[model samples]
Target: MKLITEKAELFFDLMWSLQFFINTELKILTKIKNRKEYAALPQKDKQVVREKIYEQPELIDKYIASNPDRLNDNHLSIIKQWKNFIKGDFYIERYLKNHAIFVGDNNVYGVLGLHDAFDHLFPSNYLPIYVKTILLPFQGRIVYDGLMQVYQVSFGGGIKRSLSETYMQAKQNNKIITTLEKTRVKIESKAFVEVEQENIWTNEIEQLKSLSKKLKGGDGQPAINSPVFSLVKASIALADKALFDPSDIDALTKELQKVERAVRKVENTLDRML
Candidate 1:
């Protein structure tokens, strides 16, 4: 096991303690029914509230309290599904593995979207479903042709879940498109910067070439001592100073793994953007 300095671990501890802050600050967006709607659905058809929904007992409740105006049918379906996910009312294990059951092998979108025509290329589509990818308590709507909403509606409860309009949610699709473009630009920039850093450091440490001018004692001679002599001395000192303990092979390996994971995320995001 590689040891981390106590100071270095402080941030990890701080972040861990505040892990739930995001969920607390941002209201969970979900649907709930009113007494009238509850009374309207025939008891035979309306699924009864079970011990499960009462379990987390709080996830759905919190979500509902945040979004009270969503009595519409589309809202109810997603709410039920969300409840099912939290309560494991349907597929608990599958959820742990897949997030959403109907989405057995899907993508999980915490605050992202596949809100596009090409979303079909996404594996398992995305979580929150392509249906409710947007529809947050504060946020307005999903984009694209509203095609995904129609597709989501066609699945179970028909047109009730479909939204008619697009581009209503601050035009987030536009933001995502812009972000993707920026990410691509960033990658290109990194490529050039990386090459430049390598070259600069190489010049800083490169060894001096052998004296081009032969020195003859008290005779005609080219300069033996020159600018390269200074560079060679600096390079030797730099190489020594930069050397650090390499005993923690495992630690170094882990750091490399982290870099690889970060790169992978960037690559995946770029792929999605593309």
Candidate 2:
């Protein structure tokens, strides 16, 4: 069994904690949005309504305080704005009209988007379902995209690439473009993981070994022509890895056995469509 080092364990713990915080914040925002008072508030006054409805301002404060190094100028500005909104420091309509430029922006969403991408690539469930090798690069791409948004106000750029847009472009070109393409784009844009610039994509995948180390199980490979083939291959690769874990080997084996059955069922259904 490969023993998880203390540093690796700590890093994983931090990743989990960050994911939890992002989910909690998203829930709070959703709750505020669903409130009747939120709907009744004037368009400009909604920020105030959100502030009044959100119960845990301290959580936001704590996050900012703890992650000073992670925050950029845009993050600091948003934090200040949030603090002001929470304190009810300005007249609602006037403040809204004056700060109309910042009305729809929420830095928290960028953070949440980053975490969501991480979860998509490396699900926290017992049976993980994505290839670390393939997913890590995509994960980096997602982080880059999220950070761009988080610092968008302070850092002016014409436009940024979207994962969905990139996927579509790949499909149109009849290519199964993966992480290599994103890396090339990052290099061309001169944004190839500069941590000093608050880019988290740097070194995120350095520890990951190649997928070849874990791809020795199934005969059922996804069709390269499929638009979502990359994702499907990733999932299969993950299942394969889980089935062969050195420790608790049977635990993942049974879980992925179930997944294999499900995949077979789906394939049979698709076969009928032919």
Candidate 3:
């Protein structure tokens, strides 16, 4: 019955809403990848996560306002709950572990490496310039893309049919010229996965800010340490080291002990979060 657990649960609930949208996009993509059709999806893949970050309070309110006939009282109640939950302190990565979910480490890898999951089956090493530029954000620190890179070649011809050139990057990462725009095509390869990572990271950042707000009690007092924040920071760092620096196992092993100390420092608070 601790507020710590209550807060953590709220964070998880908000993240769950976003993660579900992400999973839905992945599922839909699995079935179809054609250009004309993908453009016509009811929900733009990135917008699903964007609404949670950008629209949030207003969007939820708008949904309730516009869909009076469909929403009813129960629907209104659910949206209220969601808003309140996010406004609280729940954290998805840490709290979910209490239930024996296989997250916080290797699981984080899969979620983080979603964008380049393609190169794993296709071995885009042939396009080093492309992959290097694209993978810059997440390359060494997170995900099993290096491991997946070896296996991309094994993907059957059918799986490799659609995006044989610049892959997913060329298809999605494009630019439209208009209104005095020069004839320049700076097609930056920003994939949907990149946006997803940013959303999750932003959510964690917001959680830290919320914890800071609460710990300071809105006064000028120094912010107290948030145990949930500590756990998340340490967990994310450890995940980065493990996946990115596999060769330096000894170094990571030593660092993990330090991370464990951090977790222990906030263990009691984390227990409450859980």
Best by lDDT: 3
The TM-score, computed over Cα atoms with residue i paired to residue i, of candidate 3 is 0.19
Query: Which consecutive 10 residues in model 2 have the weakest lDDT in total?
Result: 91-100
* Model 1 pairs whose backbones collide: none
Q: Candidate 2: give the clashing pairs.
A: none
lDDT of each: 0.31, 0.33, 0.36
Best of the two (1, 2) by lDDT: 2
Per-residue alpha-carbon lDDT of candidate 3 for residues 1-274, written as tens digits (9 for 90 to 100): 0124443343333333433433344453454444334434444453444345333445555555654335356535444333321111111111111120001111111112332333343333332211210110111121111111121223344533422332333223331111111111122223433543454455555555455444322255323355545556666666556544545878788778877877676665546655
**Which of the two, 1 or 3, has more lDDT?**
3
Mind giving the per-residue lDDT tens digits that candidate 1 earns over 133-167? 12111012111111122234223333213211121
Sliding window of 10 residues with minimal summed lDDT for model 3: 93-102
